[model samples]
Target: MRISDVLEKFDISSEREDYATIHDIVESGIVFKGTNLWILIFAILIASVGLNVNSTAVIIGAMLISPLMGPILGMGYSIATYDFPLLKKAFVNYLFAVVAGLLTSAAYFYITPIYQAHSELLARTQPTIYDVIIALVGGLAGIVAISSKLKGNVIPGVAIATALMPPLCTAGYGLATANWPFFFGALYLLTINTVFIGSATLFTVRLLRYPIRFLANESQKNMANRWVTFIVLLTTVPSIYYGYVLVQKENFTQNANNFIQNESFIEGDYLLKTELDANRKQIRLIYGGKTISEEEKTRLSQRKNIYGLAGVSIIVQQGFSVSEINKELSLSDRYQAEINRLKSELSHNIQQQDSVIKAQKLGGQLYKEIKPLFPEIDYCSASKQSFFVTSGATRNYTVVVLGSNQPVRTNRDLARITQWLKVRMKSDSLKIYIEKTAI
Candidate 1:
C-alpha cells in the first residue's frame, strides 16, 4: 500500500476535527447554565467524597465527569484566537466554577465525619515540577485529541491525568478544617494546574494555526496583549520558584533518607522517629536504645557533601525505645517516660482518616505476601507511615516490624523484604524494623 494509504489506514490524523470544529467542541462545554451546572455541583460532591474516603477510583471518575476543564480550555482558546469577549466570558465562568467547586467541597467536608487529610488529599497540597509537566503534556494531548475526531478515547485519560477536579476539593477540605497552610498550598496546586494546562492548550492551538474569530479592535487587542503578558508572568514566575523549592526538598529528602539508612541502624542504635524540616534546614533523627556518638556524628557530617548536603544541620535527637508490650521485662518510670515521648512523637499524624478500612486490607495483604517469604516469623505487624513524597507519589511507606526472637531472615532477608514492600506497595520508601522479642 502507498504511504498515504498506510497512514490513513492507521487512521492517524485522518479523523481530526478542524479548527472551527474544535472551537465549537470546547465552546459548547463553556456554559454552566442548567444541567451542566448541576453536573458540576454533583461532580464536586463526588470528588470531595472520594477524597474523604481516600478512593482513587472515585476521584478519577469525578475528574472525568467534571466540566472544570471546559473553561480552562476555553481561556486557552481565547488567547489562541485573540477573542477578548470569549476570554472575558471564559474567565468569569472559570472563576464562578472554581468558587462553586470550593464551596460544594467545603460544605460536604464540613458535614462529613472524616476530618483528616488522607493520602489522596495530601497528594494535591504541593504542586511539583512533575505535575506542571503532566498538566502541560496532558493539555497538549487534550487539545490534539479534541482536534481529532478520535476524541472520546483520549479525552477521559487526559481528564484523569490532568486532575482538574481534586485540588479544588482538597482546598475545600483545607477550608473546612481551617488548615490555612493546606488550603493555600492546595490553591497554589490548582493554580499550577490551571495555568500550565491553559498554556499548553494555547501552545497547541497556535501550533495548529487556529484562526482568530471575532478579533478585538486594535487598541483593545494591544491592551489585551499587555494584560495577557502580565497574567502569564504573574502565574508562571511563582510556579518556577515553587518548582525549584520542590526540587530542593526532594534532594534534601533523598540525602536524609540515605543518612538514615547508613547511620541510623547501629549495634545499639535504632531510629524511633526521623523528622526532616526543610524550612528549618535540619534533619532531626530520634534514636532508641542508644544515642548516636559524636564520632559517628562527625563521620555523618563529613559525608554531608558526598550526600549533597552542605549547609543542612543534622540533629541526633535522643529518643526512647518504641518497644512492643514486653511481658518479658517490666520497665522503670524513666523507661516508661521515654517510651511515652517516643510513642507520642512517632505516632504524630501517623493514622489518617479512613485508615481503619485500609489497615484491614493492608494487614491481610502483608501477611499473605510475607507468609510465602518467611513463614517462621509468627507475628508480623504492618502499619503505614506516610509523609509527602515531595514530588510524585503519595509519599507513604509501610512500616513492618517483625516480632520474633529467631529470625530466619538475615540482613539480606531484610533488604529483600524492603524491596518486596517497595515493589508490592509501589512505594520506594519502606521501613522494616526487626524487634527481637519472645511471644
Candidate 2:
C-alpha cells in the first residue's frame, strides 16, 4: 500500500473505541516486577562478565534474563492511550531500570579480573540506521504480542530483538574503562533503541485498536493526548537526527573497506579505523599503509553517499609487508612447482648419505659384521672419553662404553642406551638408529 494509506491505518483517527487504558496495560507488567527485576539484575551481571571475558554466550544469557522490555513497552502503551499518569510511572520506571542496569554492570566490571574489552562491547558502541530499524520492527512485534488474544511464546524472540541489556553493559564497560567516546556512543545506541521501540509500539497500538477501558474526565483526557503528542515528538526528533548520523558512519565504513580492496594493498597487513561523528560532521579514516594518493581519495569521494559527508580526513601510514602484493600474486602460479622440486631433492640426498655411511662403517667387506648399536648419539668425543647419547622419538639409548675402543659390551647395554636416547628426544616423529664409531 501507499505511504498515505499505511499512515492512515495506524493513525489515532482510525483507532476503535474498545481501546484499553494505559493504567490497565501498566498494571499487567507490574505483576512481573519481582520476576523482571531479578532477571534484569541477573542479565546485567551476566552481560558485565561477558564483556569482561569477551564471551558471546554469557552476554546472550544475560540478554535472556533481562526484564527491560516491560518498562519500555509500558512507556509505549502509556503514550498511545494518552494516559499521563501511566506515562509518568513508565518514564520513572524505565529510567530506574536503565540506571540500575548500567550501575550494576559497571560495578561488576570494576571488580572483574578481565580488564580487556570484548568485541561484543565494542559492537554496542556504534549506533546505525540498522539499529533503529531493528527496534522499530521489534516494537511492532512486541505490541502485537501484548494485544493478541492468543499469547504465544514471543518473549524469547522479543528479548533478542529488543536487546535491552547488552548496550547498558557495554556503556558500563566504557565507564569502567574511562573511555568517554565509548560511553557516549553506547549511550546514544541505547537511547536510539528505546525511542524507536517505544514509538513503534505506540504506532502498533494505535493500529491494532487495543481497548482503552478506564474512564477519565474530558479535560484530563484532552490534556493527556496533548502531552502524549509532545512526548512522541521529543522521542522522534532525536531519532531522525541519529539516523542521519548513522548514514555518515555507513559511508566511512564503505570507503575504508573499498580502500583496502585495492590491488596494491595486502588485505590482512593493515588495520583500518573509520570514525565519523555526524554532530561534528567530521569523518576520519586512519589506515596502516604507505601514503595514499589523490587518486585514492578521489575514488573514495566518488561514493554518492560519502560525498555528502564533509570534513573527511584520510591518514595512511607505513607498516611492515609480509610480501609485496604484485610479487606474491606473480609467484602463486609456480608455488606448487617449487615445493615439489625441493621435496624430491631432499629425499634423494637423504638416501645417498645413508648409503655412504653404511658402506664406510662396513669397512673391508661386511663392515666387520659389527652391529652399529647406537646410531643416534647427541655428542661423541673418543679422546675425552665421553659419549653422550640422547633419547630419540622411538627409544632412549645411552652408550657408556667405558673403553672407547670397543662398542657397548652387551646387547642389554646397547638397548638401555637406546631407551635413554628415546626418552631424551621427546619426539614422536623420530626413530632410533644405533651406530658405533671406532674410538
Candidate 3:
C-alpha cells in the first residue's frame, strides 16, 4: 500500500521478453533480400503513387507495409550490444534498403505522367523538431513492443507515425524530377528520422540493461560514445533550425494576414487581391475601384509594422485608367475590343460588393470543368488581378491560377488551358498561371 510498492506494481521489467528473443527479432528484420527487398520496393512505389495523387489513405497503407524499420532497429540494437559484426551487417543492409527504396520510387516517378508535388509530398520535404520528436518516440514504442510479452498493433502504428517510407519516396521524386531542393530536403528528413529513431533505440536498450555481446576497453567505449554523440548532434541541430524557420514563417503569415485585413481599405480604394511570399518577405497588395496616391501607399506600407511585420516589403498596385490601357494595347482591333470589354466588366465588378463571391463561384465552375480534361490539376482559382506592367502601368486581368499536382510540362499545355479558360469564362483578356502543388 506504500507509494514505492504501488509504483513497483507498474514496472515494465516483469513484462519484458527474453534478451535472446529481442535480439533474434531485431537481427531477423535487418536483411534486405528476397521477400523483404520486394516488399520495400512495393511499399516505396505505393507511397510514391499516393504522394503523386495526394491520397492520405494510400500513403498510410504504404507506411504500414514498409520494411524500413527493420535495419534501423538492427543498427541501434547492434550498437547498444557492442556487436561489431552485427553492426556492420546491419549498416550494409540498411544502405541496401535505402538504395532500393530510392531507386524503385525514382523509377516509378520518372515513368508516371502525373509528377506534381502535392501537399503530402511537400509535408515530408521540410523536417522540423516535431518530426524528430515523432521518430524518437515512435522508435521507443517500437522497441518496447518488440521486447514486450504481449505484442499487438504497436509496430504498425509506430511505422505509420514515424513515416520512414514517404520521405524516401519524396526523395526519389526529387531525383526523378531533378529537383535538388526537394531531393535534399526529403533526404534530410529521412536522415533525421533514421538517426533519431536509432538513437532512441540505443537509449531504451541501455535503460533496459540489454547484455552486451562483446567486451570493450575504456578507450573503445569512449570512442564509440563520441561517435554516437557526434551523429546525434549533426542530425538534430539542423532540425532545430528548421523548426525555428517554420515557426517564423507561420508567424509571418499570420501577421501578414492581420495587416491585410486591417489595412485593406486605403482612402477610396479597396483591396482586390493580396499575394504573400513568406520566403522573400514580400507582400503584394492589389487595389481596385479608385487609384491610390503615393501618400496612401506609404501610409499602408508603414502600417505593416503594427502587425509585427517590421522588415517585410509591401508593394501596392492600383487599378489603371482606360487611356493607360489604350496606350499599352496598341494592337489589332480585336485586341482593342477585348480590352474595352474587360474594362467594362472590371468597372461593374468593382462596383459590386460580391466580387469575391463571384470570383469564388467562377473558380468552382472552372475546377469542375477542368478536372476531367486536366487530371493533373488539383485546384483552380479565378481572380481579378491588377498586374504591374513593364510600362509603369497596372492592368487588371482575370487570372486563373491552377494548382497542379504535376508540373505543366510545356508552354503548349499552359496555352491550351488559357484558351479553354477564356472561352469558358467568356473573357478574352484572361491569363493562366500554373502553380506546382505535389508529386
Candidate 4:
C-alpha cells in the first residue's frame, strides 16, 4: 500500500484545531507550564544527592521527576504530525530543559561538601551502545504507553529506559572537574539519547500510521517530490552515521572483553575495568594486581598490538597487597583533604549551634551508666559534659564516669548502668565494674 493511503487507514493524528504558535506547544499541551524550570531543577538536585550517596533509589526518583521527557516527546509529536510551529517550540523547550538540568546539578555538586564520585556518575561518563539501545527501547515504550490504554506505572519503565538524570549529572561533574573527557562523553550520551528517542518516536509514529499533508496540492504532487527527497536524504545520513558508530562500539567492547577474559593475568589474580573510547582509539584498564615483571609487560604490549590496538596507552598499578589495596580504596586524596578542611568548618559551626552542649551531656550520661555494668569497659578520661570508655568482650571493661556532681547512689543507677552495658556489649552477660566515678 502507498504510505499515505496506509496512514489514512490508521488515522494517526487526531485532528486538533487550536494548534498555534510555538508557545502553544506547552501552553496547550498536557504538560503544565511555568513549573518546567523548577521541576528540572528539583530533579537535578535529587539526582545530585543520589550520586553522592550511591543510592539507586534516589537516582530513579530523580529520573521520574525529570521534566525532560515532555519537551522531547512533544518534539516527536510535532514532527510526526507536521506541526512546524509546535516543532520549533518543542525543540526550544528541550534545549531549555537540558541547560537547566546541567546547571542545577552543577551548582548542587559545586557547593556540596561531598567530593567523592559515585558509581552512577562514573557509569554515565562511559557511553556504550548499550545506552543507545536503552534509550531506543525506552522511547518506543514511552510512546506506546502514551498512545495506548495500558498506561499504568509508566514512570518506572521510563526511569529505567531513558536515563535522563545521569548524563546531566555527569555533565555537571565534567564542568566542576574540568575533565574534558567527562564533559564530552556526557555530551555524547545526551546526543545519543536524543537521536535514538527521537528516531524511535518517529518510527513508532510511522507504525501507528500518522498522516501528513503534503504542502503541494494533488495536482502539484510532482513538485513536492523534490522536497520529500531532500528531507529523507538529510535525515538518513545522520541516522546511518549514528548506527555505524554504535555498531563499532559494540564490536570494540566485545573484542576487548573477550581479550581481557582470556588474558592469563585476569585469572582470579585481578579485577579489571576496561573503558574503550573508540573515537579516540584509547583504552583505559583499571586493574588490581602486583606489578608485572618486565617479561609480562612485554607480553601485554604484544597482546595490545595483536588486538589491533597498538597505539593505545596503558596505566598499570600494583595493588595486590592488602596495604596497597586499602590505600587504593581510600577516598581520593582531594576528597579526604576536603573532609579535613571541614573540621574547622564544623568547629566554627558547632559554637554557633547550641546542640553541641546537649550532645556532650548525652555522651556523658551514656558513658556514666555504661562503666558499672560491664567490668570490661575502660574509661580513660571524663569531664562534666562527657566521658570515654574502651570495652570489648575479650577484655575487662574499664569505665570512667563523668558528672557535674557524683554517680547516682541508688539501685536505679546500677540497674540503668547494667542495661546500658548489656546493650553496648550486644549481650546480656553478667559483669559489673565501679571504676573511678568523678564529680
Q: Give the worst 10-residue stretch by lDDT in candidate 1.
A: 321-330
Question: What's the candidate order when arranged by decreasing lDDT?
Answer: 3, 1, 4, 2
Q: For residues 1-439, could you state the per-residue lDDT of candidate 2 as single tens digits?
A: 8999888876543232333443455555643357677777888898888877888788778777777877778878766766556767778888888888878888888888788766887888766667778888988877776665444777667778777788888888788878878888888878777877788888877676656544667887778667656765664566577668767666766654444333223223233333445355444444344555666656555442444434554444334232442243346433542443344355556767887675444233211222354433323311112234565333333222222334556888766755654454343333334345544
Model 1: number of backbone collisions: 0
Candidate 3 lDDT at 303 equals 86
Candidate 4 residue lDDT tens string, 14-37: 532232332243334424357767
Model 3, global lDDT: 0.86
Task: Output the number of the lDDT-best candidate.
Answer: 3
**Model 2 TM-score relative to the real fold:** 0.54
Q: For this target, which candidate reaches the highest TM-score against the unseen true structure?
A: 3
Report the Cα RMSD per candidate: 18.2, 22.0, 21.9, 20.7
What's the C-alpha lDDT at position 47 in model 1?
A: 94
Q: Hey, what RMSD does candidate 2 come out at?
A: 22.0
Models 1 onward score TM values of: 0.66, 0.54, 0.72, 0.50
Task: Give lDDT tens digits, candidate 1, residues 314-339.
Answer: 88765355363233234563365455
Report the number of clashing residue pairs per model.
Answer: 0, 33, 9, 9
